[model samples]
Target: MKKKVIVSVAATVISLSTVIPLNVTNPAPTEAQETQQQPRYMTRAEIPAQYKWKTDHIYSSKARWEADIKKAELLSGVFKKNYQGKLAKSAAILKKALEDYSTLSRIQDKAFVYANLNADVNLTNPDLQAALDRAEKMATAVSENTAWFSPEVVEIPTKQMNKYLQDKSLSAYKYVLSDIIRTKSHTLSQDQEELLAKLSPLSSTGSDVYSRLSTEIKFPKITDSDGKEVQLTQTNFISFMESKDRNVRKQAYEAYYGTLEKFKGSFAQSLSSHVQSHNIRADVRNYKSALEAALIPNDIPVKVYDQLIHSVKKGLPLMHRYMDLKKKMLGVDELHMYDIYTPIVDAEEKYISYEEAQKQVMEGLKPLGDDYAKILKEAFGGGWVDVYSTDDKKSGAYQWGAYDTHPYLLLNYQGTKGDVATIAHELGHAAHSYLSKKEQPYLTSGYATFTAEVASTLNENLLWNSEYKKAKTKAEKMRLLNQRLENFRTTLFRQTQFAEFEKAIHELEQKGESINAATLKKVYGEINKKYYGKRMAADEEIAMEWARIPHFYDHKFYVYQYATSFAASAALSKQLLQQGAPAVKRIKEKFLEAGGSSDPISILKGAGVDMSSSKPIDEAMTVFEETLNELEKLINEK
Candidate 1:
């Protein structure tokens, strides 16, 4: 099953490793405080000159990106005028059109990436923000103009296209054309498709407005555990939650949710509009439901979604046990939401510097074969990663690249254990992109979300396993195990809970039921209860959790994929670690090389997983159970 997380507020132009909640804002510290505070902006000069490879692309300056934006605008007319009605005349024409479109798209990709990267570096810069907005609008306009291309290609008579494929001139586009034909069943009429295309901007307006408000609006002040007042900006709020102090975590949580509660009605409206947009589009395309329509394009089976939810639901008892163990380790009389963030075993919490983290990550991933490890080592050594978080730096980490350019990772690295894990995660994405781009054609390099998170999560699992084994003391081992369980619970079970809420909301909208703040809270509250079980209180503040999540506003029913992918990753990582070379060979051949050449299910099956059955999910749940049992045993012994 696919699970959605929070979506970035800027442009939904490219796929990133993960989605940060949009409300995550990092405002500039006041001038008086600036002297004492770390510089909010990292100067380019401050970046090690040797690490220039961290950003391989040259479109770094806003002025350069603005020039590229103009260049992209020039190609808009070419696609708009030439390919409109001429697509169906001949196979040769179709092939040429596809080539031209791909070339234009590649150029646009560079421009959009440049703009976004620039904007992300400084959200306070108006010029960069304008550049991003203009580039996205241009891309959308061009996309709408070319909307007829796919439907038209799909409308071509199958026999005629088959005969055309027999000619040598059209053979290069055989796969592309076949993919178009594969969508024949989903294509709407030309007029309906055109209408939907035109309406898309309007339809997405709700999300756009929500993004603006969430990212730009200021939140009220909240007190921290130290009795110091801090502004509840997006960046600080998340930082506060990650605090080792229980009181600080609780204060941050309540403060953030309290702000969200005030805007609950607006959030509900935006969410409703997004859901309605999906339902209407699915209906127009003649699908049974929005979920089916969303999955169909990626060739995912609806049964996969069903099996994921069902299997994860069956694992709820394990989650409850894990929570209970956590409470016991914390020496709390009762486990409240506040106790969740505290580390299980007390140690001098180490902060691995970015350099050390990179070195550790390279060592941890050695099991993926020497070649894989070599590339990873080069990535670190060659400056492929931008580390260190500064004020106005993007709030989260992500790996991004065009097929023509090497993958680059942007990280807001805070020296925390979680930050080390994040380094592994982003590099996993970079490695996957690197391998896919090396082995597959550009057209096939980008896989769907169903398979995308596997590589990243696998690296994280490997890192955790390595760390767990290396710990010397029982306290250290228990601490590492606790951290691992926390990751599983948050990434897997928590995401599944989010998925369930998304599904319920979509269903309600489909039934023409009005979605308001009260209704959303009630529904989410119930799902919260089910996932957490009876071990912890489902605090009323938790109901507003849905509103705080930006994913619900952007991607429709997308959170489940996180749970599914992490489950798949756990199983794959265990096999590779235990079974060695044969497992590694199978993973590389079946999963990595398969790319978008086959559906996700087939790819996973080839790599020794069957999402069609409940085996993988069940096995993942079993891992969770074992971890919980280990924690329980440790607590009892203590």
Candidate 2:
């Protein structure tokens, strides 16, 4: 899903899309790196040029970047002077204003991406960081100047708006104009809208504080399986949990969550304030609840959110069955929370180099047909990806770029099976953005977050399926099968668990109940227990887990799409395998290339999955059940 820097316009906020990658980090850290010599990427200078993204393609120098920022500033002033209150005067005026807005938006996006891309690779560089700040400031200023657009457009009479919609000159902006009219009830007067825009920065203060606090946290050190002391970190916590040594996992788990336990009150206060902001905004906007306010703007039905929670709750027995199998496979007396991340079967961990990763991604993605394959080939050596970890390079992976340029990816790639999957996942995002920008206008080129992960997750399914078919041993099959089951577990079940918590807190706040540390922990622990079922030990330390989730602070009600999108892709993957080229055609034309030109549900329906109903969720559950059955049968064999 894309991240947005929201600039309040009326009761609603205008969202500028930012590249937020769904990181498929190395799931199982290799023992070879611990014992053997490995290639070092100590700095950007040491990294080969081929492995670096082509940032020059975006802007060659700081001077050029500065020039665009200056030009954008001038354009924004001119736009405001010329069209501030003139949008509803005539169809021709509205068409020109929108075109100018599009051009300005594109330039601003390019400037922002260039600064952030360079800054991410060289975090220690002050110049790059300054440039990024300047770009961000420019974005905020530009958005503020254009805050009048929505309110003015909505103020137009319905009779006149209909006539304008039929005019060919305004055809490019028809959907946007219609959307504005759709929210007319929610749109405030121009003066009120400007006041809200001015107050927008205060809304994100709690989120900013949380970010600073979390980043500054000092995780306690613990003894590793090697019997040496290692400092725990947010990034490496999960890897430690996957340790073969149960004591190491227990230490890491207790130390990590225990450290979080120290700051529970501060985290609770920050989170409570954010919840208050959501409720206040919803009340001002005339929405029935915070959930409606969040979902309505995206054209998503509240029922879709409800259906996910209901279906997943009904499917919890399957999850309980999974936990029972996990306990049996590990031969443990009791399955504690710490034991969940450790693999139940041992499979060989292979170190795949970046070049090998390229080959695997291309070959694995071949089922999508020639057009999709061609894009994959172009992405490999076309200067699209930064393929290794270097000092001060931002951690994890993501796909991002302006619509005018080819998509760019930043990855701290360590050659594991998970790294190969990351390539496919990020490239799927790149391919989707690439095709959408090529086919659609600037107004609709960016797709909704609701459908964002469908392409990426489907790519993962295709790649893994290709690899699973090639497995020569039972262990390999078990490992990959278990990996798929883990995807369903984390993305579907765990995220729904989060979605439930988010809904509960907002509802509590809406009901005028206090939301503090005690309330949050009580709610999160209960949901976590419910999702994991009775087989889990439901450790007390796990209750503090709510404090560490950055998503809750930054994005509200956003996790459910991870579950919904995963289900959609699972259903689509089955169709791709069974139906072949016809399925590929539908996926490419109706889904990948459609972009925001249509509603997300409509686009998905055109691509052959109907998320508006329960079938996709049910299909995903069936997949999880079957995978578990196959893995259990293998584990039970003499």
Candidate 3:
């Protein structure tokens, strides 16, 4: 018999493409321009309609969304009645059952999308949050009803399953069926699967608690460089960290991390519980480790995860060299954590308006061909983006949508160069989803998390090159180069550090060790020390940094993809820059448009990057070393 495993619909929550949070800085307006330029909006209505997404595109009214929820719930009962025992009767019956299941899932997915998109824009609104709660309950019900699917399918006699697989009618679901069969050993009994699905709603308790605390916790005010007191906020903390004045950065860092420190106990509880849940699930599913449980569902090997940490650790000295360069450029006696974010070039930063950011993103992505250009134009004008930082809006950025609607992006776009890159990054996700939905069946429309970052990071790399080509001065080039190098630090090295920390915590839990605030801080601080090296001033606040990462609460084993995808994108972007149209053609056909029709590794290999080997990671580090070399040369020339 196949290994017993439970596949819950809750796993589908990751369809939303969220980028790892980066401390992107927005330029503060001068005092003289304060009256003319407001950096943030107090309400959604204060922003222009063009900058907001059309949530109505998904559902024209609340009544319509409610109707779909009811429709999905009703269909869930019908599905359980019709296909619960008849899945293996015949090839035609199996195909019909799968199609009906897809239809029901699509409706549930759409309803889930509407509630989440609304809740995200204004997390403070009770009505929206209530609606989101209802949507989650409905999704769990749908999952519970359809919980018999894989078990029954796996129970089909092997000879009969081979006949069904050979049927032309089931050709579209070929990969889907094969993957389900591949997990036969992991497929649990129908009763056990149903029970697990019933408990799926409880799985998100820790994540929900952390989300509320992170958004609701208030921080004290600090004096800005302009001598004006501004309240420290999650949205602007990064901006403060990037301030030209050392005192502003220091105050922001201390205030932010200090407040988080007060809530460390609660944060630690949330994280420990989250880790414990993964461990229990892994044990129940009979997996060797929580890491294996998380990776295997996505068809990712544990070795790939291990190799990322291994490769990144080998590249640590290069990161140290970059840090040493930062010390030299900033002329700091001690390179404290706060000093790391400020631009070392000492030049005034320019603000890029949302409209200007769109133009830059459009121009940057031009190499993807005219077909993609048309999609880009529609994505910009079709109201696919919700821009500007407004009160109660969610922090960070992501792209999400249903199969029936165009992809949508939620961004707190500040007029900064990094914000411009973010525009390109999120749009890459939107375009990938849009194309995949247009080309693939609903069952295969969503891509795996493993491959999600490839398009987004590739867009950023292209945007970097485009902006670099436009740089007219040494200072401008240096600033752009520094930003690129910073990407290597944050996206590649730093995320792997997070991945390592995540793995360590899960292992500790499996060993029956007690996990609390002190444990989390020690583990995170040690990892941070190794990655940043001895040059960084030892600060207790750095340990508290782990408390702020939302991904740890929401998604297990997710950060490593940022590192892996960066490596893959570096390889793909090189081909695009050098080979031009032919490379773009292959990437779209083999990668973006493939969706989840095949495993992530095979899809990427088809696109000309072999992630199974260390070549991509090694190549990416070489680029990082080369970038440091060029920057050093430019600095010496002066």
Top model by lDDT, which number? Answer: 3
Q: Candidate 3 versus the native: TM-score?
A: 0.95
lDDT head-to-head 1 vs 3, winner: 3
TM agreement with the true structure for every prediction: 0.88, 0.91, 0.95
Per TM-score, what order, best first? 3, 2, 1
Q: Which lDDT value does model 1 have at 165?
A: 69
Q: Candidate 2 or 3, higher lDDT?
A: 3
Model 2 vs. true fold: TM = 0.91
lDDT of 1 by residue, 583-602 (tens): 98999878876556667788
lDDT per residue as tens, model 3, 1-638? 11112111111211322222322333343442354343567998777777788888778899999999999999999999988888878898899888888888878878888898888888899999999999988888888898889899999999999998899999998889898998787788999999988987777788888989988899999999999999998888888988989999999999999999999999999998899889988888889999999999889999999999999999999999999999999888899899888887766776666666778988998888899887777777776778888768888888887776677788887677778888888877877887777778877777877788888889999999988889999988888889989999989999999999999999999999988999999999999999999878998899999988888998889889989999999889889999999999999999988888899999999999999998899999999999888888889994
The runs of at least 3 residues in candidate 2 whose Cα sits more than 4 Å from the true structure, single-residue gaps closed, are 1-46, 122-126, 389-393
lDDT of 2 by residue, 1-638 (tens): 01122211001011113322323222232344454323466689987677788787777787998999988878987988999878778888888888888888888888887887898788768888788779877876776777777888888888999999999888876877787777788777777776766676677777767765776677888999789998787756776888889999999999999988898888988999899999988888889999998888778999999999999999999999988888988899999999998888887666676766888998888889988876776666567778777546665677887766777877777666777888888888888888887778877887776887788888889998999999998998999898888888888999899999999999999999999889999999999999888778869999988887777887778778878998998889889999999999989999988878777899999999999999999889998999999998888788
The local distance difference test score of each candidate is: 0.72, 0.80, 0.84
Tell me the alpha-carbon RMSD of every candidate: 5.8, 4.9, 4.7
Model 1 accuracy (lDDT, Cα):
0.72
